[model samples]
Target chain A: MAFEFEYSAKNPLYPVSYLKLRAMHSRLEIIWTGQAENQAQGLAQRVEQEMLAMEREFNRFSEKSPLAVLNLKAAMEDVSVGEDLFMALELSEAFRRGTRGYFDIATSTSCGKDMVSYTLNPKSHSVRFNAPEVTLDLGGFAKGFALERVSRMLSDEGVERALLNFGSSSISALGTHPYGEWWAVGVDHTKQHGIVAKEVRLKDSAMSVSGRNYKGEYHIVNPHTGASVAAEELILVEGRSALVCEVLSTALYAAPKTEREAIVSQYDGYRASEILCGDCGSVSIRKIG
Target chain B: MNRKEFLSDCGKIGFAGVTLSLFPWLQSCSDKAKQEVKGEKARIGIIGTGSRGCFHIKHLVQMPNVEVVALCDNYRPHLEDAAQYYPKAKLYDDYRHLLEQRDVEGVIIATPLYLHAPMTLDALSAGKRVFCEKSMGYTLDECLEVYNKRKETNGVLFIGQQRLFDPKYIKAMSMIHEGKIGDVVGVRNYWYRNNNWRRDVPSPELERHINWRLYSEYSRGLMTELACHQLQNGSWALGMLPEQVMGSGHLVHWLKEDKRDVYDCVSAIFTYPNGVNMTFESIISNKHFGMGEQILGTNGTIDLVTGMYYSDEPAPKGSGMHQLIAQIESGVMSNSVFAGTSWAAESSPLAPGVPIMTNVKVVTGESTVGAEADGSRELLEAFIHATITGRQPEKVLEESYYATQFALLADKAMHENQILRLDEKYKIPYTPLK
Candidate 1:
């Protein structure tokens, strides 16, 4: 599935510059408008470069990646990570705690440890595992972190209008579309033939989508149970920060339907919804804040 | 360190690392060099005032450093039509007369396929740099003759396989070399156009002259006219010529027309030295598939036409917990892991085509040529730059020679019904047909 960053010169004064690239086995698009031509171009290039760097550092598939190296040595001894990896790990820890362990990153087929087994040293920018089984995978948090960073970069570059989409799952809108009042994003319902089940309009906001892994099996493995999430639920989170949206979306999807509202209420300026896919192909959408 | 300082340091390291690591080799031909060359103008001439010749004029007129000084064609109508575009250019009915113009430093040959070798030879012999339209010649002998002449005259020869200069293609090739897609295993290219492949003739005598592409004596039909670009791309991407070729062609749908001797459809498979095979298909009866080239590497597939690529393996995804986070964020859910053990069932995601040229914004709807046709303008610029600077484009002759050789051999393989290997004897001894 290829994704394109559609740019329009409809308003020449605010010409859009967009680039689409692949990273983390997903399509990422960055569209920037309302800046000087050269600045917009530079920001787009910087965004892509940052995303690729994050992929190189965080991707577990690459054995040479920083995350893989950390996963290898963190279990045995304290592993001093680079500044970027350390920050991402810190955010992962925060989300893991904030989601009450529902948003664990180590509960994979390869690494199955919860946040309690990991300890961070802020002064050294290092992490150590309390248990030998503890392993770190930043795949879940990387895109969100990258998006948030890119948004900051764009904003720093004085880009007043831009849209950063990391796959269809994570999106950050800075300002608004060149022509429209707000950056409108669609929430795709995969079970419903990948239709636009919901539309979100944002100005200086970020949104993330998490639900049915394209694979038919339970991809959302519960850290507490070590079992895959069986509930067919679609979760969407809109918040001021992409990382926050991503964390809340995943936590709510894994949390029971009754607990979703409570989980979302904990975060200010965060709105979430769950689309439950019933066995009969029926969908139930419940909104929460 | 604080979060802000850490983040800032990380961003700087990443930006520098990625920028330095990628595309180090492409730094040789910098925009500064192009701008330097663009400062000077080179006077050029156009021979064979046909559709392609006129297209060259259109792009040439737009170029800053190129002045179309002369136009030549035996056909009066084509000459007149081209003359309308460059009214001040010295027009001539004979190409030899056009070559005689002392001010014409370079010539763009977009005549019939059969005329490529002779026109290029004349142009080079006249001390004018040549940009000949592709399928270097009608036969192996003609191609060799031109290749030898280029070496003998020390003239700059750039064949019009525009894709060679296409930014998208250059970028794609760079990615392929960078192992972004791993090793290229195979290539599949097809050109499908729904047309009778005919041109209107003012007189019966002009039928053969005007529609030369449909005649075996003047052209190799789809192989030379259409498939050469794709074949050139395949060879370029593979960085080697085909060792052997096997293929077939048939009149198929256009048999009712007696004037046309060339086949309407052709298909060939070329095996390169690395054991990689390139499959080419062209048909004039269908336009559904349109035209595109696919370079299938072990890791990914690049669609040269669309400027996009799809990976063979699914993108490196985050863990299940990552998916759960995303699910919660999006407010949608279905099943857990949809990807089964069957790799075949899994679909790889498509990424936007990487830009071949750095520091150039790919703007859509600009008067600048579309991605498919931009090669012409780029090639023209390179040709003009070469003419003025006296610096020949790197590997253009060698690439052109191999592409033409492969094209002719593929046609031979199809007609003879045999797997033909490129022999040394074919490269030597330029035997001009009597």
Candidate 2:
């Protein structure tokens, strides 16, 4: 893995800013600025450290790692894991149930945890499970959540200008630039294709856009019926936190109309604007707050 | 903890688990078959068990096998109403406290709009089902979060979409679908009630949080509270959600900036997929005509207001095909039958026989056409039955979520005042649908 940084913003809401990006099989970018920029860098390093640790314990692609030891131990019925991995396991269980199996973390092509389930070892940082299922894909929002934890740490460490983007469609912003209150965010409306919707101005917020329409293709398929959400092309939501946005964008796409608005309203500090395109080529946009 | 939950949890998962909801299967069973084949009753607890809560409570009380075990509200007076129904049920002043009750199975949260999401998450996490009132929550995240959480929980959820349950709406939808008014091409929805509701000032702070539907904090103003319902109606009938919504909102009659953040009147146009457009208007200042959908189709128009369906009774018999046969018979033929004919002998170049559809009666049926069928009632009952049966209904979550998704689009369309795309992402940078 390699690390890189830059400061590119076109909305004019931000000036020269620092963006921390790391490239591996996938990409991870951490964008931070303002009073907390330096501390945010350190937090990014720590997040990288945690990522390494998690990879060591979970990565099946790495032969030198102790993952085989943990799996072999579980084969003989013995193993353990730390709190973060354990909580992730529990959360995974909740997510599977909550989404009625949508947004599944265990179903990725590579790096998904299909083969093995992580078992806990209350005191030690060690991990063990019955067997290797498939690769563990944190590509969804696990890495994003890790970045969120890191961002929180940066805030603790006084990193004022902090913005982090986890490769898969997730971003975390902390304490806007030295000049503004909220970051400027622009999105394309779903119907009037090629038209910009409202410009969102927010701070200490996380905005996540799920890929129902990416490069004009719907990458997400409803896990329930094996068909993609019928009309949702793009959904732009802004709220107090990205975790909420991360999970919401996933669920709202599959949500039924009767419950869509009510469901969107169930999160704190989050608002969503949806664009739906159908066979007729007419698009409709709805904003929820 | 309340007495009933305390006892139930004490009997089931023990003290630590009492804070969680208890599955109905844990109840005592008489026959062994009862334990295996039977499902648990849909348990429910209501937040702000006030006027609306009381109304929902009445419904729950009558539904067999279900229980209304917990009631919550910050105000003691509101709690009193629910307490009257479930005297022994737990009562909570802090709404979140109700989230910990073990026996509570589901929830009917009709609280102030601002508290919608916080209360919803707490309930969903606590493992209780939920039924939130209309206009869902204050922000998009909250709405989407509740939606996602509901999906995550796979719990039975119902929004207070009364029109979704109303017979009037169901019938109109079917008539349109059955093509009672010909192939529907356009529609107009209007909801203009003369009164914009009245509320007294209990206190300064209460104005913003309490009676919130009148303000922007709890509701999306008239668009959310009024137009959203009808917008849904039009979408259901037309078989598509709007992509771009651009409209104007004006607070003409009652204007109080400090107390309300919503416009009292909204005139909007939503463009649908098939190029069918719906013009929706809601005015609080003066309700001129009324509320209903005018679906313009190829044959005729379906008026949802009067529960009527009309069409220019199929064009006069032979008026169309007769002209063709007649023209052939009177043709100034050449020497042979296969020879070319002249345009001169044609039926009346200036005034042709009832020129196709132009000749069809503009008003085929009487001024008042079809009568009110129980279609709307059937639609409502279908939704209600789906909730009762645990069987996925016709307008399933996948269907309704898109509807809410559409409502959201209309708002953006109105805000941007330009035709916008429908599939907009939450916040990662986007390149629109078109």
Candidate 3:
């Protein structure tokens, strides 16, 4: 449950800098390499601003957050939404359909079978909840969404080498490490302290790791069943899209074993791996395409 | 990050990494020792029950592989306070009495700077493993004597050079040695505190006994007490010792009211074999800077205390993908596995440096006695493992010996105001512990 979120460059010779902040119920970190100090500071401030904007828009726990306001008003009538919120809803809906409802943002317990919990009005830029009990939560989706945006921001800023990580779960890497071919990261064991479950090498890609935390409490819920899934294995998904990786990791972990490959097959250039700790004191890694 | 991940990260340097380099002795500091012991406990005895001694006791009680068999202190209150942690352990007023016990397999000497050499020598001679606190000795002669005694007794001796066991230092040192920060330029070390460096005395006669650090006879003041730890940074990063040392000391602040003869402000500069200078300065008047040890290189700087690296060069103006493409076209790219992502416009150029290792608790060195996440606990754990396995951690004694000499020599350089080299008599051949 206590994960080690460490990022290192191989034999790095250039000056690498990073920015750390608390956002969206997680610690958000951005590391920029081979950049001048002033440029890195400017770029880091921009990235921080981007993530903060998204966090303010997506955070439902805050009373003044846009999501909370929408959740409260949309049930009774169509509520106007901003571009960021609207985009997040559209992405969530797409992933929900892509994962066959396994990645639902709207709690399914409040909706009828085979029914969409909320309707998005593109023309009016508004959302209306179909059911009175419908509540929208982006706790699992915001990190990925923010990482994807930050990734694009770094790409846009002409930053060649960088790493962005959110709460040790959502991660994005641009270019290779200054010294090595890839940015190396370790997935910590879910049950054992300090034990590395998997070592993932990433370059120009993103990865999401999902599992029960230190207390053996599952954070990912099965959107279809409306209950936390009890998975013994840690699920890791890596791909070019940070958003896709985050959605798939959560969906695959919540879904049953038989349906994981099918769900992953829906996405291109993505790979999922199930890390299991065996009684024989060895880690068993099964790769899925 | 935990022990394994930290050690594993430090394992990968471009050249000879910290784990695989000169300090081969750190093998015992890893978690492998816990596995080797197989739940067996190492019987440990404490010679002093001051703040640092209790600090060790705090770590000892938590360790499942260590048992506090004996506790000794001349002060009854201190002994009683420490006994509360492990009431089962026998208590003694005198350390010699504690050393006589057959059950005490190893002893942790945290009495004072002056007592380190004598207690360590006695513990080793008594057929017990010794974990002596730094500086290794009160004087250069004592340091040499203790070094020779370890060989004479063929005993397992662990010095309090905790940086060698710290994960942040290991990671930073690895990066430094790997040319991450470019060629080593210079080393800057400073410790600033605002306290009077005094402890409450129960009676009038116990002033020197309670406040040992403020006296020349009992301690080397700030040099041995503080600078010894930071002095190791230059040698560890450059892989060589200083050739000469010169400095000045003054009783700047806490002067008239106290009988303390030790200087409150001291500055020493050590010139290495490569002609690079390592500077040390401690002032008790201000606590603004706190404490910091930095290794300055041509390309960048590494703050060993805070574990951050700052670069001297300016950042490039374009995207990494674009830079990679340019490098590829120019045939200057060293990274073979390059996949181009989207390239874009340039941003403003200014940024704060990154931490060498993330998730580590960075101590600001405010606590005069002990600080958390400062490698003290791990150092004690390594010593306990050494005692249980009967294997001496190689090069630890040499490092501690030289660090002690630096402190003592710096003191001499300050008092005499002349540059002093290590006496040929004190130089000992480096040997790996078998």
Highest lDDT: give the candidate number: 3
For candidate 1, the share of real interface contacts preserved is 0.00
Q: Supply every candidate's count of residue pairs whose N, Cα or C atoms clash at under 3 angstroms.
A: 36, 107, 17
Each prediction's RMSD over C-alphas, in Å, is 17.2, 34.4, 18.7
Candidate 3 wrong stretches, greater than 4 Å: A1-289, B1-18, B317-350, B431-434
> What's the i-RMS for candidate 2 in angstroms?
33.9
Per-residue lDDT tens digits for candidate 2, residues A1-289, read 4554443333233323343345323345554433234544555567677666766644545665454444445444545555665566566645555545555544432223232244445566444444444334444545546656667866776666655555434556777634445544444344443344444554788766664433345556554554666654556566776766776776666655555577676565678767554543455668754
The list of candidate 1 runs beyond 4 A from truth reads: A1-195, A198-289, B1-29, B35-39, B316-373, B428-434
For candidate 2, please provide the TM-score of chain A on its own.
Answer: 0.68
Best by the TM-score measure: 3
lDDT of 2 by residue, B1-434 (tens): 22232233223323222211211111211133234324655556778875656765665665455666788888676788779888988889876778778766667787765676777777777766666655565666666777778767766565555445333344445545656667767878876666646555567765554566676545677666656556666566666566666777767777753445577777887887777788888776665665556777786666655545555453322321122123323431111111000111112222212211111112111111111221222222232333344443323333334445455555556666666565455322212111
Which ranges in model 2 have alpha carbons more than 4 Å from their true place?
A: A1-289, B1-40, B256-258, B314-394, B426-434
Candidate 3 chain B lowest-lDDT run of ten: B338-347
DockQ of each candidate, alpha-carbon based: 0.02, 0.00, 0.01
The Cα error of candidate 1 at residue A190, in Å, is 7.0
Per prediction, the TM-score for chain B is: 0.82, 0.68, 0.89
DockQ of 2: 0.00
